[model samples]
Target: MRILGIDPGYAIVGFGALDYTRNTFTTLQYGAITTKAHTTFEDRLSEIYDDMTQLLAAVKPDAMAIETLFYTTNQKTVIAVAEARGVLLLCARQAGVPVFEYTPLQVKQSVSGYGKATKKQVQEMTRTLLKLPAVPKPDDTADALAMAICHAYSYRSKQYGVALTKRQQMGYF
Candidate 1:
């Protein structure tokens, strides 16, 4: 499966594409869609939508995993990020990609095997797991990749059941 992971923000929406098969991951692409601070807010949103549309076209992911928004002290920033996230979710929905939302703590746990892992620890584990020479830069990009890894692990949790045991006996999971 090809999965696109997103860390949404108006100023910089980070993205990563990875191919998962047989319990392994292959990083296809990772980058960010950035809007200029000087641009009007509406224009920034437009830019984000356009860039995200182009990214979906190029990546053609089977599914998308996104980090869910959490409350923050800065209401303005929260609102802006939420708007950007809406665009991200809409693009995925329109493209017929199944969406999965994970919290930051879940991502940390899946990527680092520790729910309380530090940001640096998560980044380092992501780098090591993907066998990258170094962690992806711009923080957000690394975060996006971590989201992808989280989904890969989530599939494991989803497949566990007594009913699935018969299916697995026939070769599944």
Candidate 2:
């Protein structure tokens, strides 16, 4: 299975693609779609949408795993990221890819086996899992890879007829 993971943001949308087979993960691509900070908000969003669409076309992932919005203090930031996430989801849906959302806690637990794992721990574990020479650059890009790893593990288990509970299926455990 090929999975695309997304870390959505108006200024920087990060993406990682990986192919999973028989519990092994092979990195295909990892990068960020960056928009100039000085650009108009509409222009930034448009840039993100276009870049994401192109990525979907190039990667042709069977599914997408995205981080769910989880901001409590910054309303503006939350709204902007949410809008970017909507565009990301639209790109996946248009490409006929199933989309799955995971929370920060879930991502950490899936990557590092601890929900309270630090960012560096998740990054290091993602590198180890994908057998990469080094952790992917740009924090967002690493995060995107972690999301992909999470989905790969989950999907692989499911392929063996392991029934995940609702909480686990939704990545809340």
Candidate 3:
């Protein structure tokens, strides 16, 4: 299965693509779609939509995994991220890809076997799982890769009829 993972943001939308087969992963690509600060918000969103459309066309992934929105305190920031995520999801839906959402805790648990794993731990585990010499640059890029790994692991378990808990089924650790 080919899976595309996205970490959506207006300024920087990170993406990672992977092919999973026979219990192995092949990293296809990993990068970020960056928008300039000088650009208008509408223009930035358009750019993101266009880039995501092209990425979907290029990767042709069977499934897409995205990080679910989690807000700490800033309502304005949360709303912006939510808008970005909406565009990302629209692109995936238009491309006929099944989208699965995962939380930060779920991603950490899937990648590091610990729900409370630190960001560094998740990044290191993602690098190790992909057999990379070093962690991917730009923390968002690594986070995207971790999202892909989480989906791959969860999908594999589901295919084997492993009865994951409701929280796990809902992509929460």
Among residues 3 or more apart in sequence or in different chains, the pairs in candidate 3 whose N, CA or C atoms overlap within 3 Å are none
Residues 43-113, model 3: lDDT tens digits: 99999999999999999999999999998799998998899999999999999999999999999999999
lDDT of 1: 0.89
Q: Return the TM-score for candidate 1, rounded to 2 decimals.
A: 0.92
**Model 2 CA deviation exceeding 4 Å by range:** 158-173
Candidate 3's error at 166, in angstroms?
A: 23
- In model 3, how large is the Cα lDDT of residue 152? 95
lDDT of 1 by residue, 1-173 (tens): 89999999999988999998766789999989999999999999999888988899999998899999999899999999999999899988888888999999999989999999999999999899888999998899999999999987785567565345554544455
Which candidate has the top score in lDDT?
Answer: 3
lDDT of 2: 0.88
- How does each model score on TM-score? 0.92, 0.90, 0.92
For model 3 the local lDDT of residue 114 reads: 100
Model 1, residue 56: displacement in angstroms?
0.8
Task: Identify the runs in model 3 with alpha carbons over 4 angstroms from their true place.
Answer: 163-173
- The residue-by-residue lDDT of candidate 2 on 131-157, one tens digit each, is 999999898999999999998876656
* Residue-level lDDT for 100 in candidate 3: 94
